[model samples]
Target: MKKTDIILLTGLIGSIIFSNFAGFEKKLDKIEHEVLRMHILANSDTEYDQNLKLKVRDKLLENSDEIFGGCENLEEMKIRANEKLDEINDIVLDVIHANGYNYTAQTQLVNMEFDAREYGDITMPAGKYDALRVTIGEAEGHNWWCVMYPPLCIPAAEKVESDEQAAEDYFEAEELDIMKNPDKYEVRFKCVELFRGLKEKLSK
Candidate 1:
């Protein structure tokens, strides 16, 4: 199958579009927002983490082809979607560990708890904390999101997709104009949603 033909699990294509796309943005903008949200949502869930998610998602959208191109199959698609997420997780681990944070894979959550005082940080609890997330190939939206154990979960596949020949790209980027896109109407409506969100957020 072509790299463009990589299909997520039978039902998740919509969630990917809706959630990743942020549901109410223009086609191109939606893609950008969704990608950004992933980075934000994946973080250990702090203000900085959320902002970073938005930034990374935008970067991923700018290089949709690079991101999407890597998804030649189900496995590849998950990895493509998760590329930034994995990188961020690695960075978070390094910082936490350096500060004597415990990286315990208890039940697979990788609990990273530390003394805020040790890091000279404030407003954080003394309890153990870790990144909580829905694993790759497994987000189900209002639909059947597969199993739930810790932050990771399994994907539901009808038939396994064919193997992909390439890994995901991290930097290379190009864009297709959404105005002339095959789904122009969808893009138009989504754009309005994003505009409204911006207006509302800004007005507040």
Candidate 2:
């Protein structure tokens, strides 16, 4: 996403946060979680069949014990999670790519090694992905998810750059309707325009 595109989205998100402060927490949580998964999917370029993606993701979630040995608490669990994060990320990418899109699967979870999807186009920090799980597209549809500490991007700083705060501050998911098919608002419009501009630049 472009820098200007992010600011425009910021305006849209601002509206939701203000109007729906009452229902904001739950709403934001949903959006946050979805975006993380979506990010993987979007970048994965995996197969097009949603059913396949569902099956693979379900298996991963279900087999957590086999994939990860029993860990007692958050810290130990986190260590295990980080390891599986890479494997899970790879699995999802394989599913998506096999199904049929053209995306690059990126697994860096740090905030700094990140590039802004909406704004600064900046990179995030490099470390454990402790703060949030941010995927760009969901299996269900066109939206995204955000959450704290998803496994894949957690412990791979040696492998990747930072990924912190790489996205815009999102509004309540309900307000933006991002969980479902997001309406093509000004943000989408700007995205279209950005693509056009880039095309023109390339032509030049």
Model 1, TM vs. native: 0.21
lDDT by residue (74-178, candidate 1, tens digit) is 435444445554544454444435445443211122333322211111011122333223221112211111111110111112122211101012111212223
Q: Name the 10 consecutive residues with the lowest summed lDDT in model 1.
A: 162-171
Candidate number with greatest lDDT: 2
Instruction: Evaluate residue 59 in candidate 1 and report its C-alpha lDDT on the 0 to 100 scale.
Output: 41
TM-scores for all candidates: the values are 0.21, 0.32
Superposed on all Cα atoms, the candidates' RMSDs to the truth, in angstroms, are: 19.9, 15.2
Position 57, candidate 2: lDDT: 50
